[model samples]
Every structure is written in C-alpha cells, then in structure tokens.
Target: MAAPLFLLAPPRSYTSLINAMLGQHPQAFGLPELCLFNVPLLKDLWIRASDEMSNEAKTRQGILRAVAEIYGGEQTAATVKMAQHWCAARQELSTGLVYQEIVERLHPLVAVEKSPSYTISLERMQAIRAAFPDARYLHLIRHPVGQCKSVMALNEGAFALYVNAIEFLEDRAIIEPQIAWHDLNINILNFLAEVPPELQMRVRGEDIMENPREHLAAICRWAGLRDDDEAVEDMMHPERSPFACFGPINALFGNDPNFLSGPTFRPHKVKFPSLTKPVPWRDDNQGLKPEVLALAHEFGYQ
Candidate 1:
C-alpha cells in the first residue's frame, strides 16, 4: 500500500478545493476530510471534542463517505448506512489501523486527503506521523489577513474559539484567529522538521489558485506521478471528484460546507488584503497585532 499525501492548513485556507483538485488526478483518489487523526481512537470521534462548536456529528462523515465509496461501491443513503455499520463493527480498532484499511483498499492510486481540523492539535498531527511514517505532506498556506478574514466570515471564527485561540487583554479576552493561523502553521513546521525534506512541501494557496497548471504539475512531479497534459487536464476539474460534492444526508460533509456547496475550480487571482488595514471582524476597528504582522511578513507578505 502507498502512503497517503495529506494537505495541512488551518480552516478556510483553500484545503477543500486543493484536495479535490489533486484527487481528481487520474492516478490519485481524493478523500473527504477524514478527520481520523483528530482522535487517537475510533470511538473518540463519536465523542464531542469541544463545547465551543457543534462540529462532532460531521467528524465521522468523511470517513463514512470514504468507506461507502471505497467498499460499498457508492455514496447512496443505504451505502452510507453500511459505512456506519462498518465503523461500528470496528469500534475498538485504533484510528491508525482503520485509516490504513482505507489506504490499502485504494492501492496503486495515491490517496490525497485534507482535514483542517487535524492542525488544531499537535498530538493529532503526531498521530498521522505514527500511522504512516513515510506519508508525504503538503503544508498549504494562505496569507494571514486573507485566512483570518475568511475564518471570521465563517460562523464568526468558531474554529479559532474551538481551539482556544483567545487573546487576553488587561480587562477582557477576544477570539483572535491569527493565533490559530500562526500556531497551526508552527505545529506543521515543527512536525516537518523531523520529516525527510523529500517527503514534505509547502505551497502558497494563492499561488495554486491563480496558476494551478504550473503548481499542480510541480506537485505531481514531486509525488512521482505523471505530469503530462492529460494528467494536468484531469486536475482542472475538482468538481469531477467523487467526494467533491455533498454526500447523502447521513454523510453530508467531510469538508467545508461553503466549498461543498460549490467545489468547482475556476482559475483566478485571489485578491490579497492590505496587512495594515483594520480587520473587518473586529468591532474595535483595530489592525492586526504586531506579532501577527511579523508572522505574516515571514510568510513573504508585504
């Protein structure tokens, strides 16, 4: 069985689109956000990870969708039910072993997966490394301003709060999403430090959005896959991926709802917001913090 390739990024960082695009490759199988690593055991997924957000139900959706498509031969409601039974039968298994079963089932085709939730905790990421030591990782990044803005736009930065990314002032505390953005990237960087250079890569999300053909080809080459015109052509339609759409009612999302609503890849330049401007989500009319700006600058943003 081939080790899977994981795309690492915080939520709202274009992970869904990119994962589908890469999965659309003829030689690859793209998976829904199988948040397997979010918990150490299979049963933990059914337990609520936090009270800050109601994100627990969908945690199993990705894995169910994957199992239905890979084993049950379709993603219909009945098949999704079957996937649930499949999980129940193996409730005592380790998450790593269960994940490996999916990977092995899709042998000869590289599995491409992304679960932004995986970056919420270092232990979650470490779980992945332990499962597949040779797994390749693509540390996909977005501009801090753009990423943080998108995070706030989605459910009012619930993701940041879900991970306790709060900034405390002398009198009060505010949900500071940049803390999650910076800290998640740092988690990935620190984890990758021990991984062989050839097994890890970093790509700017905007770079891939604007000119995917070039970046996609480079990624395919790095993964030892075909980079011919036919391969590149296949990647242009992420909407064609099997897991690119909302699944049955029982398994509606293994990805961002905003993205699953429309998974198509339309090439265009993503406008970058000015770093010095006040963040729209802030009622205080305040700009980014100095620490946040410093981190953004390190990411090559002016």
Candidate 2:
C-alpha cells in the first residue's frame, strides 16, 4: 500500500472539501471517512447494535461509495450489495487491516482520507500509526473563532458535546466552544509532535479554500506527487470525485450530507477575524479569552 495520508482536523473545519480535493488528484484515491478505528471488528460497522449515539454507520457510506466506484463501476442498489459483500469478506479483520487491504488494492496511488471522528481520541490515531507506521498526515487547522462558530452553528454544538471536546467544562457554565476548538487542535499538535517532520504537513484550511491552485500545488509538492498544471486542474474539480455526489441509500455519507447533496467548488477569499474582538456568535461584548488568543497565534493568526 502507498503511504496513507490522513487529513487531521476537528469536525466542521472544511475537512470534507479539502479531503475530496486532494483525493481528486490523479495519483490519489480519496476515500470517505471509513471510521474503521472506531471499532475493533469490521462487522460492528454493519450491526446497528446501540440505542444510543454510535457512529458505526459512518463507516458504511464510504465503503459503499468506494465499492460502487472501484468494483461495480457505478453506485446503484446492486453495487451497494456488492459493497456489503466486500465488507463481509473482511468482517473478521481489524479496521486498519481492512483499510490497508483497500489501500493496497489502490497501489501506486496514495490513499487520502479524513475522518473528523479520529480527532476525538488520541488512541484512534495511535491505532492508525500502529497499522501503518509510515503513513503521512496533513494537520489542517482553522482559526478558533471560525472553527467554533461553525461547530456551534451545526446542531447547537452537538459536535462539541459528542467529542467531550471541551478543554474545561467550567464551573461558570459558559458555552465556551473556543475551549473545544483550541483543545482539539492542541490534541492534534501534541500527538503529531512525535511524528517525523517529513511525514507530516500543516496547511490552513482557509488558505486552501481561498487560493486552491497555489496551495494545492504546494501540498502536491510536499506529498511528492505530480504538481503539474493538469494535476492541479484535476484537484480543483473535487466535485468529480465519486463520493462527491449523493451516496448509496445504505450509506449516505461519512461526510456532510449537505455537501454530498451539492458538492461544488467555488473560489472565494476567506476573511480572517480579529482575535481581540467580540465574535458574532457570542451575545456579550466580551472578546476572545486570552487562552483562545494564544491558540490562534499558535495557528499563525495574529
């Protein structure tokens, strides 16, 4: 298998678009959020065993979509069944083992993926490393203010609560999403510290979206993949990726359902917010807390 490339970021950080874009590269196969590490057994992905919150279903969409494309050459109910059988064949294998098998099948082309859920646990990432010690990682970051606002906007901070993402569940009972935003980013940074510099690259998501051609070329160069104009143009068409459109009914997505429904890339410059000012999401006049500011600076925001 080619060296696995992971896109690391907290949820709602534009990881979906970025991952799709990178996968669209001619020499890369961008897989959906396989989310295999969430479980030890591959069968657990198909059995909806819990009445409570379990994201196991997240595994199906990616696999189904991949099967539809790689094996069946189309995403239809028949192809979805084919995907089921493919997964069933690997039911006894560990998630990483199954994933590596897929990667191996796509050999000579790098496999690109981003499972936002992976950032929830340091152990999940460790499991990825344990499987493929030579895997490469892209530590993608967004400004805390932007990341927090996006997270809260989606399901009222449900993402935050799900990950127990907050750094400090404070006595003040303030809904400080910056706490989760800062800490999860810190989790990625701290975990990545042990990885060799050659195996990792950090890119600001805002930069990629705003100046995709330039940034994509930089990333391609870093990954040691082709950085020619044709390759860059192909990466720009992330919407062309099989998983970019509607997924099979059995597995709609490991990405944003909305994104799947209408995945298109448009160029626009992202405005960086001021760290010293009150954010629009917060009702009070209070600005970003000192700790949040520090974290923003760490990500190279002033």
Q: What TM-score does structure 1 among the candidates reach?
A: 0.95
Q: Model 2 over residues 1-302: C-alpha lDDT tens digits? A: 68889998988788989999999999998888788876777887777745223455565677767866777888887888888889888898898888888888889899999988787778888888888899999999998888888888877887787766543333434466777777778778877987889999999999998899999999999898999999999998889988887766666666776678777898788888888889776666777778779878877998
lDDT of 1 by residue, 1-302 (tens): 98899999988889999999999999999999888888777878876744413578777889999999999889999999999899999888999999998899999899999998888777888899999998999999999989998998888888989989898877899999988988998888888887899999899999999999999999999988899999999999999988878888778888898988888889999899999989876778888888878878887788
Question: What's the distance in Å from true for residue 188, model 1?
Answer: 0.9
Off by over 4 Å in 1: 49-54
Candidate 2 ranges beyond 4 A from true positions: 47-56, 166-175
Task: Give every collision pair in model 2.
Answer: none
Lowest summed lDDT across 10 adjacent residues in model 2 is found at: 165-174
TM-score of each: 0.95, 0.91
